[model samples]
Target: MSNLPPLNNETIWDIINDKIDDAMVNQLVWDCLGYSYDNSSQQWDINNVASEWREEYPEPPNFIENRPPTVKLTRSIPPENKQLLKEELGFKGYKVGEFGPRQTRRATVANWLLSYMKQKRETSDR
Candidate 1:
């Protein structure tokens, strides 16, 4: 016996119509599962989800004319690297002054620089 709730034809159609009606839900469903309404086929299909969505909505229309530009800084090192650096450098909570040894600080800086350089090199090679 399945534990799923009963969904009749009407209920299913209602849900589909609701999704089609709401742009936000439509976009979300498209992004999450790449599901979108098909006008030509006259039925919903996921033949080429990504391509179909892209073709339908080429790009998000400039709804906000003068919206603030988004700025994203990609960190070379992962969060775990930062956490490890803090732990290895002995950064204590409530400590006001320089904590770890100068050598440890130097080593951390060197390691970060090396990793950054390596990432750059790999990207450039590709």
Candidate 2:
């Protein structure tokens, strides 16, 4: 059983605010709210959703027009690499057939590796 709290309008707004900058916050807030509404009610109501969002968050930040991505990269881990990663990380109880949970653990391990590498480089440079 997941311990995550149920996501509501305010929680969605707070999540957006935390993950995104002010310029993108309003757009994401509306996007998440609109999606949640449509997902629950099976209907679209962008205008009403926007209105409600505006009422909740008065003086919303200015919308930023889409800009070209600064950089792009593609990455994929092969099965052999995943096996190596599992062995290297000493991951436990992760079944081979499950992708989602394994992928999450792989990402966590990758991040830890990167942080360790960075610290090692910094120490060696000193």
Candidate 3:
């Protein structure tokens, strides 16, 4: 049996600060074994569970009006989007030290904006 505690709104907010939905967390708790959410600690605990099903990053990026990117090149972008960003727009920098998946809140929100901007550009171009 799992030692995961039943999650409440407060606990969920405390964990990810409302970055993802409750149902998703509940489903993860159900599907992933050797993991548990602590109500008091407001965090998830894993016991020797090696899986790509969990991580944490809540620092979202900032944005303003829809404006063309100024930089012509960049290396600070998380590896996944570096190529795509160069093709579509561009990025500034963020000292990630090395290339890897950045599942940060900033990355999450920036991803959404990038998708939205891409779609709009495609639609307008078409």
Q: In model 1, which residue pairs have backbone atoms overlapping below 3 Å?
A: none
Q: Kindly report which residue pairs in candidate 2 clash with one another.
A: none
Estimated TM-score for each candidate:
0.24, 0.23, 0.25
Alpha-carbon lDDT, every model? 0.35, 0.35, 0.36
Misplaced by over 4 Å in model 1 are 1-76, 79-100
- Over all chains combined, what TM-score does candidate 2 have? 0.23
Residue-level lDDT of model 1, residues 1-126, one tens digit each, is 122222233322332233223333223323333344567876555654556344643443211121110000013245545443235333333234634333232333333433344455578999
Task: Report the alpha-carbon TM-score of model 1 versus the true structure.
Answer: 0.24
The list of candidate 2 runs beyond 4 A from truth reads 1-99
Candidate 1 residue-wise lDDT at 73: 9
Full candidate order by lDDT, most accurate first: 3, 2, 1
1-126, model 3: which lDDT tens digit per residue?
243334443333332333545344333333322345567887655543334222311211111111111111122234555444335444433457632232233333343334434455678998
Using TM-score as the measure, what is the rank order of every candidate, best first? 3, 1, 2
Off by over 4 Å in 3: 1-83, 97-103
